[model samples]
Target: MSKDTDNSNLTADNSANTTSSPSNDRSANNVAPNEVTFALAQSHFLVGDISANADKMRQLAIQARDQGADVIVFPELALLGYPPQDLLLRPSLSGRIKSALSALSDIQDIVMIVGYPHVDHHGTFNSAAILHNGHQKGFYHKQFLPNYGVFDERRYFDKGRNQVLFDYKGITIGLLICEDLWEKSPIADLKQQGVDIIVSLNASPFETGKQDMRKTMLTQRSREHKVPIVYVNAVGGQDDLVFDGGSIVAQADGSIAHEAPRFLDQLMLATLNVDSNTFNTQEKAPLTLSRESEMYQALVVGLRDYVNHSGFGGVLVGLSGGIDSALTLCIAVDALGADKVYAVMMPYEFTSKISLEDAQAQARRLNVSYTVCPIFDAVEGIRHTLAPLFNKSPADTTEENIQARARGVILMALSNKFGHLVITTGNKSELAVGYSTLYGDMAGGFDVLKDVYKSQVYNLASYRNRLEDTPVIPERVITRPPSAELRPDQKDQDSLPDYEVLDGILTLYIDEDMGYQAIVDKGFDADMVAKTIKMVDNSEYKRRQSPIGTKISQRAFGRERRYPLVNKWSINS
Candidate 1:
């Protein structure tokens, strides 16, 4: 759904045509239900890694059982990973998933609630299986399938209709999916019908302090509906998204009993005593990570999982010893260990020897593998190759691009031969103004700092290096004019405005979605704004091919950011 679409009224009546078996009720009465503890198991999963994911589920189930959990709750799409866009179209994979579900059901001694794609006569469904009493007792289809901003859920699954309550060990627990809890009607309707608790399975992506927002919303909902809520979310990275599995429980009186940390995967066992006693909450919410720390961890985990899950042995970066490449290398080293990172200094005619020296020094300080591969010969060869086409005319921007492309191609060849992934160092500000070349500087399997702006890139680089504290990036590298070193005397300021001014205009137009005239009204140069917008508008095709990056802003280039390639629309409108 778009940001504007709200469908809270999609609640369906689950009034019983037939009641629970009297024998079942008798069985429930005979069993003395004390403090019942259930485990919310968060798994780190890779997309389409079926057997590995099932093995993970089986292990979590066994561990939860050992920890005295009556039921183990997994996240949405735990079977195949979340947002399995085109993978759902494979019929054999769907069959394998169903077989895997059956295999999981065969495990004894624990009830498992697993999210997966279900194939039915009507179509495929985003569903969770209610496994108990030696059989699949019930199934719930996700109703509010999101279809916006990296979620194309509507493209695959069918919506559910009924809301049924399951009686397990004498507790009436209502089942809902991720987006279902976002809608108030389902939980409210269940509470009106006298449900005890809501068990929601989710794969919600991490976006800064989304956990705090979830806590606030669920706490208010618990107060609004007079029912406790247990939220279980998936943990890991899939392409651009990183799920911070912060499984939490909120009591009806607006108190949170248990809260898990963000980023790390865990199996949390929460015990809730439900009875005819007065409706009053007794537990306090656990202290979650502060907002700054939360965003920091999100970036760390995002880079970590992106490296590990993509099957890259290490990372190869063309380091210019500038703040951008320095920060990118620091993050890569931190994420994939210094031993796994291979840095190459690809200096051209404009490159200063200070850049090469500082980069080598910083690599030594970090204990990373460093190499120097000057591109002057390759530049001449490329100029030689294209000379016949250009009739040996004066070299232009095309020649500069040839140099960048030579570096990119060499990095990619290293990536191919050695199983290392090339990390692109261009930040969002450079990408926004078409300062980075396509198939040249932008050719990489992933971008570590693509969402960050240029000025913020310098700050983060400085923070990571800690010259005042420990020094990860060399001081000389930080103290230099920003340059791509494409020509004999080239600098970033020559092609674009100062980063301070450029980042400000891009923020207003890109993040806030402001129009051209509105940006001009903010006292920015009209000609600069027009030029920046034109560059941004022309770079749509390049952005489309760029690897997915973690979303740090309201509008990131990977998923939340969408644009038309063949368009003449100007922001003046």
Candidate 2:
């Protein structure tokens, strides 16, 4: 049952309740003879797959019970998956949720807190169900529905106005959904009811420093409330979001007792001392990954899940011997393994000899299947066929574009024949200002570096080389001048500003959403800012047709930033 709305205390007296068996002594308070064993299952669930998710929950529950856990907790929306997005609107989902709940009742030994969607006469709600001894005890609806960037929970759920408290053996416990722990009201309300511990179910997505933020918040909450906390989070990639399963536990003193490894699925077990209001874990806290390592894992997990969930056989990368393609190839091999990755180097007449050598060296180093397909014949054939129609027009970007399109044709043909998904290699800087040829280098099912800037591309390559004992990308690929190699001595700087300057301008204008004048105020050249903004504005059509990619930054092209393709509101600095 829900608590009273008037802030009155809602307490259920379990002093005499002896329905469930106790694992430890119940009366001694000096030494915490009575302790609660909590199993935090940091699981990776498929979105909208109710049956599979329910089955996984059952398996995890049985495993926890076998380990002598008194209660177990799953992540937010574990049964229906997180951010079911508009899927909650479907009437059929209610039936599937019911079936899942019925299936979850089969585990009869331990108590489980499972997150899912709940419906009633009022409306739908993001809720958590409490199961004890194979029966539905009660449930708690999420109180705060986050509505800011990437979160639109208010559109689907009615805010829960009460706290849910349950009794496990001789100890009193409470539950909070993902966003509820972030606010002060929910925990304060639970404190009013005298909860011994707080168990949070989360589906928190990964940002650069999100794990640290979580730990800080949990520490503050525990110390402020003088109550320990056990947090369980969902792990895996869903679309553009990647949840870095870093489930944690904090004692009343605001000290971390255990933290699960990032980007992994784990079952965290801990013991809560009721008398001392502290908890401890046998497992050591996982070492925090470096910035590069964290971002790299995010890309790998995002690509792996997308490929596996989408039912693709493998990935094919267009290795151009440049930093962008070289980094993309390394990510592909790391994500799907070398055997599953195929590297193709399509060189034309203008392609440099050094580029050819670097491409071959990288392919051999990574142990991926390599192919050298010369596109000179294809480029000449197209030009020859169009010569009469054009009346012998002087060669321009059209010829350069033809070379790129020929390479695209080869990659797509290989994909069609072998069922391998093509991975595009264009970086964010080129994409920001329309430097990339649409349907040429952009022709792929996925763009691994669509959100990564050209400046970041070099850093990632160096990071990869340093991460491993041996370098997979050659030194020439990392040190050489960036080029399209579609025309002789064609350097990217000749067409656009230096990547360091261009990337800085794009981040301010695009990611920060600054005006042209505002960007100039940030110590940037006014002419360059205007030119870059103009290119970005004109390239909306190209971006609209670009493939989706993993979102590693605060602002990415596909879902994070949305701009109208035909808007005429240009800022005149």
Which one is best on lDDT? 2
lDDT of 2 by residue, 1-573 (tens): 232222112223221122322222223223233566789999899999999999999999888877767678999999998868999999898888998899887776567889999987878988888776556767888999998767889889998877877665445678899899999999998888878788899999887778889999999999999888888999998887889999998888898998899999998889887556678665556888887888889988988888889888899988888888899999988888999999999988887889888999999999999999899899899999999998878989998999889989999999999999998988888888999888899999888888788988888889999977988889878898899987889899999999999999999988888998889999999999999999999998999898888877777887667789887687852
lDDT of each: 0.77, 0.84
Question: Which residue pairs clash within candidate 2?
Answer: none
Structural similarity to truth (TM-score) of each candidate? 0.89, 0.92
Candidate 2's displacement at residue 514, Å, is: 3.0
Cα lDDT of candidate 1 equals 0.77
Model 1, span 1-573: residue lDDT tens: 011111111111232221231111222112235545678897787788878888988898888777777678989988888878889998687688877877776565566888888887867888887664345656777878888776888888887776766665546678889888998888877776667788899999987658878988888988888788889988877777779888887878777777776788889878766554122232554456654455556666778888887777888988887888888888787777899999998888778887888888889978899999888898888777777889867868888899899898888888889998888988999888778888888988888778888887777766665434778888767777888877776788988899999999999988889889989999999999998989899988888877767776667887687888897787655
- In model 2, state the lDDT of residue 419: 93
